[model samples]
Target: MNNYNHILAKSVENGATTLESHLESVADFAVVAARYAGMDTEVALQGALLHDIGKASVVFQKRLRSKPSPLELPFRHEIASLFFLKLVSPDLQPFMIDMIVAHHKSIYKDVSGTGIIDLENEYEEDILQFHLSDFSLWASEAIGILAELKFPGVTHETVITEEDAREAYYFALDHCRKRQKGWSQWKGLLMGADHIASAVGDFKEKVPALFADPDVSFYNRKGELYPLSLIDSDGTKKHTFVKAPTGAGKTDFLIKRCRGRIFYTLPFQASINAMYERILHDLGDHVEDIRLLHSISQLLIGEERITEKVIQDKFGASIKVLTPHQLASIAFGIRGYESVLFDLQGCDIILDEIHTYSDIMQAIVLKMIEVLNHVGCRIHVGTATIPSALEKEILEILGKEQVQYVQLSDEVLTLFNRHEIYKAEAFTDLLPVLQQAVEQEKKILIVCNRVANAQVIFEQIEELYPKTKKMLIHSRFKRGDRNRLEKELKNEYNVSPYACIVVATQVVEVSLDISFDLMITETAPIDALIQRFGRINRKRTAETIGKYKPIYIIAPPQKDPDCLPYNPKILRDSFKVLPDGGELLRETELQSLINQVYPKVEMLNIDLDAVFVDGKWRLKELWHLPKSALIEKLDIDSVVCITQEDDESGKYREADKEERILMEIPVRYSSLRWKRLKQLDIGAHPFVVPDIAYSSERGLDLAKTGAENYDTNYQIW
Candidate 1:
């Protein structure tokens, strides 16, 4: 066998490539990333070059081949790698330790309770000797590789004793234990580079353009219909707050107002998908990189579908459209947060439709705002319905002096008086009107608050309007199914000259770009309801300005328990504040109505489990809390599932993201409790639901959930 293909001699690069090349690849990426982040490239190169050198040990080589190479005590490569700290400068050793020690394991309380500090306290002398076990035999080989590079601190013929390893471990421990309150850019840089290197072999060739601003002049075209576009976006303020009706051009105005690389955040995956497609279409020709940040974003939404799971969150995207959940790690200091924090620094983040989420979620979002501000990001908020109290709280955080509050003029607001509100006791009450609309060949939309409710209505509508084209969309469909639903919702039914009805849930509330002739929606919060109203008569041109469409809103659920995921009082107040009985729901009165519903922001104290609190970072530098810790504090129950029919457990294990994403479905963990289901031992432990519970038309049928397995006749494969 040739030297390059000699598999028996390989120890690093997962036993697939040479170790020397891997170190060089990581150094190339790290140096480039450090330059982009304005950090010292020399330190970054040295850190990257030495982080994985412990793999050169003969014990590690045997272990890679599944040979019995157990030591007297346990071994951690991160620990063994610390023995060669003499190869680094004293001034830069601290930075290198942060990069190497916790790149794979946590510094302090690793989930396995085996971090460097963990063993350091348990067996001080013994731990050092275990890492230095047979070190004399392999240290020369590791040193020879380093000496070949001829970098600054590569000392020749190093004869380090157990005492030297002990001293190095304590030095790193002391540095981390007595650290200050800022995130380490060096650690983040190394992590990003290493992740990029592992996922893509040629890091230099694969890393996209970094830290370049995208040209958003495409949104600068002024039109009479879009009132906000006519307003002056250039101002002395550093941040912005714009509250206008949905069709009043909030998205375009926000994009045009940005001065740096943009982080466009939305509330839902569907909204992000729509915004990504729109931005890419408008800006893809001019910008080299405009990405959508989500787990299954590539396969379901884009042309360049990424099959390999590379670290897509690295800085340098001209614009990235994502949801708040993707940025939650920074607020709680969860895994991979430092890299995300580094990416968001000094960018223009547009928080679009920031009015959803429960009280706890609101606190999380506010915490995100605090962190973004701390990192020097310019925050811009755009919304159709924002309560006075919430707006005031956001202003206080962003600082009233720094925010440019923009509102549409009264005349322009009056021009958006497109929805005429009607009161309904139940969905059954709208049957006569819905039938009339369908008979008149009008496009119709129906919105329910929950998936089950949407499915029930969709089945009923499907049976009643057998001749009319119909579809159902919500948060529960499989990735591929939802992609198809969204495409048909936007293109097929939405544009077909023939009449159609789309029954959906709250997914349609925010930035989903769709228009219907009329709508019948369930009652939600005033802010949410206003966003839903935007879907009706939404194409606001000169011709559509004066034209009015009808919307029927069912009254709020009477019982408080049934009004879960929303405040009962807020729901009642939102319903009461609105004009009913075929009255024109004037866009001018939306803010007042919203303020009446939400008189004050419900502030919750989450400082006990948060990274940022009272304008201070609780998480110390060089350390990050475990994902389990953050998951517990956040009380997040959402989980993923794959239908038994679409079961690709074999493919999913093989890292086929494109195929695996299509098989997966997003459902709440609580919803699957005490139920008979099969779980795959993967991230989030994806559950396998029986085929009887899902439909391509209406999504998962909760009523069909049972202790039944997939039938051979129904399985896709």
Candidate 2:
């Protein structure tokens, strides 16, 4: 150990501690392995140590300087190192050659981009040229440096020749070309050693048990979720319908089956937060078993050091709650999917509010279900409203023979009766509706489709209800501000009769716990409307100050010759069949009404093969551009980091910021500061392969965790 420390210290002292340090360390690892292989330990160490001596050469050093000369084009570091090692240690030449050629992923032809590789690729012709020009320069320089430094391994005769060096270079190149792996045998040997070395001391320190088994109590035999209280029997292997209305403890029903390694996929952020809080509160001391895995909650728990690498190397949580976007990433096969799949595999998944996914999003969700099911995961579809088209799609993927549907019974639906339907010619008529609601002293949740429209209705309501207390919520508001408003709304336990109204965009549709007497909503998809209904008269048997007010579905204009209807014609037809001003308590009636509308529409599939036929997108045929530019144009900016402190401001401000490409964002340095930002895993980690946190100017900024500021002055098209 003391000798190892001395060697390590000497290497660092000799300026082998930067990015290139990984190279030298890996070489040492190769030596140890060679010793274990019973192949001349002393000779192997000598060769391995000097193998990267060429890395310290001026040619290689110049490329890694903080600022390279403007006139000098960046030279490949591998060529110089290969030249030096061949001349100095002919006995260990094979191992040194392997390390030099395959270190950079691009140069390794056979295993190029495969992530893991066994051998190195070698090319005959390129090696001849590289040996003649590059190796000669490297060998001469290396010998001179050794002599000047008075190194003990100095050799008088240069064993390298034009033909001998050419063969070695070609052998290395061909080895890489045919290896079909990311790292060469020599390189992996080195990397494994470094990993072991870095973790050696820490092994002695007591570490927390990072992983916990799934809480499988929620699931039953043969892998099916138990139905809600409304059902007389447990859920079976069939397309199950869980239709217990809001406040009927549907979450508990889903939780019972999602026992081990749970993944709660919510439709909205508000709902994700609500579920996270419920799990935290209900689980009590076991709350740590569950991890809130959305962008927002990730930000709140950002500094908790939960990463895919951390999670894989150290088991993190039993349950993870995330949004559809996070779940969608798995199907897309994005960066974190491998780790996510590893952690979530064989776990019980609860897909809450499956009804909220849009057509395009729903297609992806179905694909995700297909993949998750293939991996042996048990899933539960939990929603107040599940249309036949969506249910059929899920059933087809999950297998109609295997799925079970548990819906609300007629008795429960009858007891939870609330809401009257209202029609309006224009949004201006909402004024009279607001007056009636306020006069009755009822809490109202106004839902709008568009942010601009929501703002307009909120302004009108504030002007009319100036004396009455009211609040407005939307996605545009910072998360902190939204939470503040939610807190105020939840203050129902206060002494006085708290009279407050909330006007919000579609954000209010899910996860909010507050119950309202009335809901005035804009025309939207049936699922959205059903979700809006969940907000009003939400709790069990909460009596209205007067009779429970009817929900007003503010329809778009009757005759819009100028524009196509926001509510599709098919949906409008479905609404026409249902009678107005009638009770809508029966589950059969509600399901019948929904089945007629929201039929699945086939989507135009993207030709990914056409786009990537020759390792490039057919941008010219599709978007009239090159593939490189098309790849650069993806917008990842909408994701916000919900950290305790803003990167620039350095305070715990609950605000939403846009996510950036790996090169643009910075990792957080302060542990406390990092935990506040959301979406740290949007890209790859710098230390991990396929470095996600890359910056062209600085190489890879492993220390950054904040999103880049968007140019507010620039118009987004």
Candidate 3:
């Protein structure tokens, strides 16, 4: 007990500002996780408490040194924990240690092989390798803390030595490698033990009551009840066909069926925020029940603060709405994803906009559904249009021919008036058009295809109506600023007679709750256009507010040869990869567009890499080549800066646009490639030169090894 208290005291003393808080929260979260996974609570709680003891290791200390250390800081907490456990209990089962190690496994393989360029030579031979003894110190410290705390079953054996440390480190690494292949029996055993340990945390105890509120109703766009009875019915699970257009109360219908904890997977961040706002407005009392689970959400929303006590509460009946990436982390089993397991048990999920996901993404989502359903989750998915592949994947995964699907009734259609689309040849002179609307005191949303374009338009509008009220919104701007803008927009600051124009990018598309009287949008994908149309006249108010205004599509000038409306190459390539060949286009006017566009577009007949077979897209090395080649063929090289701070001169001068990096990448497909460059740092850019002109000090000269020296002007492909 004295030893345990010592460790606890030390942790509190040495812990960084958020370290203790993080530890407590994770411990509490672990308790709920354990119970949800059907484990005993006591062991889980203890494990969670000790998970970060590895922080006492020498490696961790080095991280806090005055000078920048060559050694990477923040060793894997799981590794540290596992090492610490072994030190105190030399005979501890290997499976128990495996759990700690495999907790936050990396799922994505770097196919580009250029993961953040390592100009600093981080992996160089001179760097010292991490030793096991360094890890044991953290483990030992943890044991002492537990002992001081007088926690039952907290006892220490013989002191740890260098040999024991080395063996444990090797064992852990091998175990982690094995886990990457697939969970082993040993892994199951560790998980079982960890589960038991976690159950001791408070989160395992009681389910929240918010989910059971009687006020919730599961209805479709038309206010009709969902067929809740279908869950137990013997008939085939008919795929729910949602014909309702966007903003027709589809989300409200989903909220009703999700009486327990809910997991809503949206297609985009905008949609997630929109849903969060809508949910907050309709069920303001349940705002606390809502857990916005997305990268953006984690950074921007929520002021309540995530504490150990809050995490201790079981996720039995709450709300967790996330983007596909956040949810993907769960399916792929990342560290944070384990919380999803705790949240999912006996939960209801709303998979909105089911058809928007790509085929590979759809495959993963279906697997997620299968796993969640197996763990006792009921899901309701809604989409403007349901594709056959998506429908088939969901059915196959759920092992049902049909799922409860309610269609929009003709009566509901009568309530939603038809929207008219006007095509404009040029928007260069849009200020006059908007000036008139501003004179009439109408709220208008001007949407552009790119941030740069949005900034240009906004600047023009501001000049045209310098004294008029206006604002610009996009993802690049700081999150707090956007939230503030949203608040002002909501209270009628942006739409009042005094408020004139709000310029925005695609971020305005989904999850934004605001409505505009008029919208001027650049040409984009059909689905995006439909989404834009939804922003206008949404509530069907009696004043005919939206009817008086016309929504304009600012079309680009017709090509010299009068090309097709859509990109023929993109359409044709999509068709070849599509499962039904071109048969899937039967429901829409896509075929004619495909025919018209293919003539002018390049590489229409190119085959996409086959990613799926036998109801799944098997992961392989070659599946990404076609996409890479396409970008290469298009001569799209992403702009990259070797320096930490970007130079703000010349073409790289800071743009007025929000979130605009100083480096102006002229290429259209740079963002895609930027994600692939690995090991990037603020080091000198390496130049590849022939062996004859090689210099050791300047930078890497790839030309010596028959690799081209990177040049900004050279084609990346």
Candidate 4:
């Protein structure tokens, strides 16, 4: 009629994004992205306009409203979208199909098993019949919007029958199924556009902000302690590498070296969150100009939560803070890897404090550096104590001549002398030290190698000092609880004048700005020890200059299994290098110490497993690489589980996706050793763990979380 208002592509909580609006928004974004990628703008725009027309169908509308969909099971709107392929010009039809066919997923072997080719092979019946069910009516609706959009080859007079739609579907399918040797930039363009349109509703207002050039003048301010801020960032070299101690303004210096939009990555989520907040403050409250990306970014507390729910736009921010996991896809060539490459092309990517990563992570980083350089990305690496071997590997990847390297003089490094080192045989040996620190009303931090160890230490301290304020945190807590712990650690404990203690795992060993008076940590990798040591005596200012704090390292366990997540040899080497007898830690000697521990760099040869190898992408035809591409190659085979109360009380179902994520707890995949356990069919498909397995104070009870003792029937609705 007057308008095809019922046609929708994006379904929000209370309202729907109409097909016409979404198409227009996506086209606007696609055209701009094309300009950056140096591709044809018109072609990109046309592809975006036609990418979501299939959502105009009645079946998709019915599904959006939660009514029974008319089309057959495992319905794919992308396949249905291909029916209108005739609207595109024949010369450009192949590119247009590339934009639509696999924009949502692959044309073949999609994880959902609903890819066009997958459906064609799996169905006994003519699957086209179900897709074309009442296509005559929806085709009219689709045409109405296309005409309204003033799309080419379509007007009020244009008409397409169900048979015409069927012919177009087969043509598009045939074109996509044919193998090619290289990837399609057209698919990348459309995917980026559609993702932007669906995520940020105010597409018009936000389109101009993509790949923004932000103000780095604030970080360029001169200071006595912040020496990097005074160094000239302008140079012929495009890449940068800086080795500096904590509080030496490494973050500010890295930002100052950027030539374009920035993607800042840390090795951990907690550090990313802390950096996100710090950058926001440093940028003078330009909240719309930045973004935070990670699995748990939405779980950020208070103001971060409010801002996060409103701004779902992952790309186009002047700056983005994330972990390496989010960008690893490009190296592996996983699904949507093209979009990530498109976003990162010609941008400045900063890998902050990356010396702490393991060999597997370092290998990924090395490959990522090569790929990023190939795509014109300027890589800036900042770390305190990088081994010589690792540095050589990165320098080789980035081209030694192309990088502007900066490191502090031994004299300047001496200014950062802040910690007095002590060693203990075990955590039990630190009890007297902990008592003295508490008696002096000193803020104490205790870090362990494992979550169980942290929990055990937390209980021991709780029993020893009942009146002392204390908290424990690790990777295993429900997201909501973890958020509270981080908030308190940052705001309450860090700022509190009273003596308190916090026991944690490796989670806090990154760019978190929390400072404590004393630290007792289990022996770890040399680089990790440096980062943990930085957490003590961290309030580096002119007045606090030369002020020294104590850090006690507990000797590492001797057994193989007990030293898990770290090599026994590396741990032993690390503990041996630690200073005992109250020796001052010289920031000048860190590199030498690091190379001593990591004498041989063990690089993972991921060439056989990676999609991007040698000099090109291995896959062709835009098909998916399988979910296992990530899960198998990395330690991300972890799973989340929900509390029985949350699932049974209907809270889990009632909550939105972000809210439901807060109720779930993450655990190692190997932790679920039982065959049969009750599961929730939503949001990671988490298992229903018993109430006894979790608490708000202590995180997931590892010993009690085994599924062997639990019966499935107890959790059934």
RMSD of each: 3.2, 11.8, 11.3, 3.2
Residue 671 C-alpha lDDT in model 3: 34
Tens digits of per-residue lDDT for model 1, 1-717: 113222222445353766666777778888887887789989998988888877776666657777563444656777777777876779889888878887776677766767777778777778777677787777777776676666565656556565676778778778767879868887788887777676666434655676778899999988888888898886688899998888888999998889989999988788888898899889988987777887657554443434223545555678988888888888888778887887888899999988876677677788899999988999999988887887888999999899988998888889989988898889998899998998889999998888888888988997898989999999888878888888888988777777899999888887888888999998899888888888888887777778899989998888988786677888888888888878998877888787787777778877777888888888877677877344454444377887765554455666555667776788777788777667877644688777778877767876666555557543441
Span of ten consecutive residues with least summed lDDT in model 1:
1-10
Tens-place lDDT per residue, model 2, 213-299, is 544442222211222543433455522345566666667767764435667788776677777777766674554456665444533
Task: Give the per-residue lDDT digits (tens) of candidate 3, residues 174-293.
Answer: 443344322222223234334333433334344243333234542323422222222232234322334355555566655654555567778765678667666656665634455565
**TM-score for model 2?**
0.62
Top of the candidates by TM-score: 1
Who is ahead in TM-score, 1 or 4?
1
Output the worst ten-in-a-row residue range by lDDT, candidate 3.
112-121
**Candidate 4 RMSD to the real structure:** 3.2
Listed in order, each prediction's TM-score against the native is 0.93, 0.62, 0.63, 0.91
Q: Residue 149: error of model 4 in Å? A: 1.7
The collision pairs in model 4 are none
Off by over 4 Å in 1: 1-17, 67-72, 148-150, 153-166, 202-204, 301-311, 628-637, 648-655, 682-684, 709-717
Whole-model Cα lDDT per candidate?
0.79, 0.50, 0.47, 0.81
Candidate 2 residue-wise lDDT at 556 = 47
Off by over 4 Å in 2: 1-208, 216-227, 230-243, 287-289, 298-316, 491-496, 542-548, 557-567, 574-579, 582-585, 603-717
